[model samples]
Target: MTKKNKKDIFSSKNLNKNPSEKNTYNIDHVLDSVFGKEGTKKRELNRKKAMVLFRAEDLINERKESGLTQQEIADKLGKDKTYISKIENGKVTPSVDLFYRYVQAIGKRVEIV
Candidate 1:
């Protein structure tokens, strides 16, 4: 067997470069192509929607992990089950304060930096 050169193995040319630089579809490129560029109204709107959906999914996962149901969380928050359902379904985006309450209700804590 031949001796291996660590430098050669760790060379920049041997490293995985960014996919967009290789003319591949990175998420930014795909989003820009499909939803217009960042700062544009369409892209901004979509970005906000995506963030809400992500938070909604995270809340759902957290609730499930805490072994709690929507009704339980709703009870903790003194809200209706449908309210939690709406938030988790991404049909509603709660304000920051409400979102913090939801997180707390799910037995998770978020510290604002």
Candidate 2:
């Protein structure tokens, strides 16, 4: 795997491009060029990782909507506030146990599909 396949969700060119520019490349072309062609192992893994990050973002939003402070969640989970902060800020990935506790902290439950 190339270094890019490991970390980039989009090429730097795409990220740095001006939104007001007249033209942009097709998303499929950009993704394929950055990660790999569709069905490649790296592409699949990158997509899954992207989904995880998206879910982590959703978790942060949901927690905020629940009106619970990070400190309060940390207290409920018997962890330090930094633990919650780390997870919500995308600095750490929550373990399954932590994920459940997070959902439970805000009066929600995880339903595996």
Candidate 3:
């Protein structure tokens, strides 16, 4: 038999379903399709959200583990209570140095691996 054309190959029974439309709940795959393989504005926004959530959660957990309140953390960092609130609420993105300071205030050190 002759080799199928590229269109014919892609037009196979299953290839018609787009990756985003497929029912796979895998986050990476969904993100790849939605944001593109590299990244898009929408994807970058979503990435920011995810990063904020992660950082907030990390901060919250560290504070809890160290038995410190937001006020206490702010005191340690010489910041206002609202500053801590904003960080924990994902309403702010801290600079790298500020993040290090915040994490240190909670009695933890940042590790790069």
RMSD from true fold, candidate 1: 11.6
TM-score for candidate 3: 0.63
Candidate 1 structure lDDT? 0.80
**lDDT (tens digit, per residue) of candidate 2 on 1-113:** 57766456465555444456656444675667766789999899888778878887888888889999889999999999988888887778888988998999998888889
* TM-score per candidate: 0.68, 0.67, 0.63
* Winner by lDDT: 2
Instruction: Count clashes in each candidate, considering only residues at least 3 apart in sequence or on different chains.
Output: 0, 0, 0
Over 35-82, each residue of candidate 3 has an lDDT whose tens digit, in order, gives 556457777887888888997997888899999999998888888999
Runs in model 1 deviating more than 4 A are 1-30
Report the lDDT tens digits of candidate 1 across residue range 4-80: 55455444665555665664333454446556798999889988888989988888888999999999988988889
> In model 2, where do residues sit more than 4 Å from their true spots?
1-26
RMSD of 2: 6.6
Report, for every candidate in turn, its global Cα lDDT versus the true structure.
0.80, 0.81, 0.76
User: Model 2 reaches what TM-score against the true structure?
Assistant: 0.67
Give the Cα-based TM-score of candidate 1 against the true structure. Answer: 0.68
